[model samples]
Target: MAEAYPLKFQENHKSHWARTLRNLGLAYHQIGDNTQALDYAKHALDIYARLAQDKPKRFEPDWAMSLNDYANLLSDKGDNTQALDYCKQALNIRERLAQDKSEDFESDWAMSLNNYANRLSDNGDSTQVLACAKQSLDIYARLAQDKPKRFEPDWAISLSNYAIRLSDNGDSTQALTCAKQALDIRERLAQNQPERFEPGWAMSLSNYANALSENGDNAQAIDFAKQALDIYARLAQDKPERFEPGWAASLNNYATYLSDNGDSTQALVYAKKALDIYARLAESNPKKRTADAERSQLNVAMLAWLITGAELVVSAEAAPDSALDYDRRPNRFYRHVLLAWAANDPAHAANALENAWQAWGAMSKAQQKNWENIFLLACGFAAARAALPPAFGTWQVQLTQFKTRRKAGLPQWMEEIARRKGFALV
Candidate 1:
């Protein structure tokens, strides 16, 4: 442009002026000039906003994204009051686009909702966050169920987020259900998707690993996290700037698993590595970095230090015969229970709840209710069955007593399990 024009006055025609201004604005933004970035983005927004179109306000997701990015820049510059207003405006536009029948881009709509919801969630607005998360999940669920191969990764993340929200609400059982869905999706996702084709697969695997650690099976979780970290590490090695955060996150997840699975020594070692990467990242202030990025880096550093200071790693003992052995009739619901447990990282008898629920849900309405009774009993027993270490000498007597009591279609048994945290039956 400079070679052609040689002077701004020579290229001051409307189109030429707009083009030069937009390009210069982008150049300014790339150099960390938030003021100019915001100005240029707004100028572009005004142009796009003013241009009339024949169609009824169709999808303008890119505009929303631009606005959102601009808001992030403003927010970073300590103008969150203005930033919040811009985000609200962008969100309203996306919501409008999502609702318009002619511009029903479900995937884009879901992405917009998820992004805005995550921002809202981080902003300490739980009410709006969950509402938007649910809306996004509903859309993603429909898409995933219809085309699992295309959208399973997204489905997994949304379900995981939803389950976490439910757990936060103290509805652990339902949370488990959602967690299982996410884990199952991720497990399926981790297989066969070529690295070149599905880059996000590694992130899905990492989330699965985290969910597993939370569920109480950190050993298994470690394996999954290792798988993810291996992939991410390679990616980071190939492209450090783009993949550093992911690699760092994977390290943090792996360290967490080690800590949970009774290997604090190794956990601390890895945690410190993550901290080093985070510290360097904080200093550099790399391109496209957000406040959330800084917070994440700080949080990882904090968690790593806090965890390393602890001398003894705590161990969890699962109930006896509580986890259904994976062999018998491992149908979908059987997988379902395992998936549910993945939400919190606890493994039950793969056979027990999965097969039971499969039978229960398959049965007629009357049969469903009957089987539900059995499920409740099994769930209660599962809690007791897991917690009794070998030192609990009365194991046989307790198991016998619990099963017998459960056979009586008793509510007390379920209430007890709910108290212990297997399925939150209460």
Candidate 2:
């Protein structure tokens, strides 16, 4: 269709040409080709801007639309500064047009406001973000009341956005209310047109879950997160290019909820899955996926630390006080100890180990029994005992006996330490 227009027609019908370029940009963006999308969007905006300058009355709206689309492409490329500038320009035009022709342009005005609010959020202007989002919600609410079929989805989206803003601002009660309302509308919409509305329904579910978690209903939050994950998983299986990002996001959210509910082991599994997807995505769209990948990587690391720490403590608790048996150690424990030793950064490692030891010391016996309360302490104690100077004489004696019994099987460093008297590993 784009090739249907010859150079002569393109020169004569610039508006049509620009629209085609904008649409091509959208097509590329939908398939995750951000570089191509950005190129096409730039060209469309350039043409639209020139046309609007010559005939503002006829071309201003189209120019604003192109500006908005270009802003979105910029945002996907992590060019927030440029995106925000374009959003402001688009909103200015849309706002003026809506005032002059409210019936025809009100929706565009509201949509622009929403876009502006999001850009403000990306820039950390929380106060303006909420104000603009609220204004957008008000307009959408009125429009939806009068024309449910046409405006309900927009209204629901605004509600979800508003809910997130409210939650971020420490208004959990109001956030939950708005989230539930959005979820209700999306649920009804999906009931009638699953293919068209299910993605929105999944998004609403995720938003509602976040609200629920904020309100301290972690169980319910996990349930809703699971629902969102299930939907995204199915959708991504069919259209990975379109849905994988959502699927990865849902997995991350689900992992968070699970961690909050005291299932760090399970959380680690899902967090790793999220990290894998985000890492793969970052390879193709680093600007868009880098932050997500970094966040997922952090989640994975923290969860692994806690789980591994707990396991180390549990294994130590089962060992005899007379001797630390090398054969009794779990592979995870051995791997962790070996890794810490190999890193050879004793100062920082010692500090972390000491902090963990102090934390374990501070815990009550009952709290100690709940490994979650002393996982770090246990991990610290095991690492310090295995790789550092003898902090406890009894453990040092046990270590000496264990090393003597397992000299042939010990790691090179440990065997070397056992061969020398009063030699510390760190």
Which RMSD does model 1 reach against the true structure? 16.7
lDDT of 2 by residue, 1-426 (tens): 465768556555898888899999998887667789989999999998988887788889999999999998887665668999999999999999999999999999999999998888766677888999999999999999999999999999999999877765557789999999999999999999999999999999999997787676778989999999999999999999889999999998998778767687898899999999989998987655655675576557656755664322211122223222211112223323333332336664455445344443433322332222123223334544564334533544444433343222223323232222223432
Question: Candidate 1: deviation at residue 328, Å?
Answer: 51
Cα distance off (Å), candidate 1, residue 421 = 30
lDDT of 2: 0.73
Cα shift from native, residue 31, model 2 (Å): 5.3
Which ranges in model 2 have alpha carbons more than 4 Å from their true place?
A: 1-12, 27-36, 279-294, 310-426
* Candidate 2 residue pairs in backbone clash: none
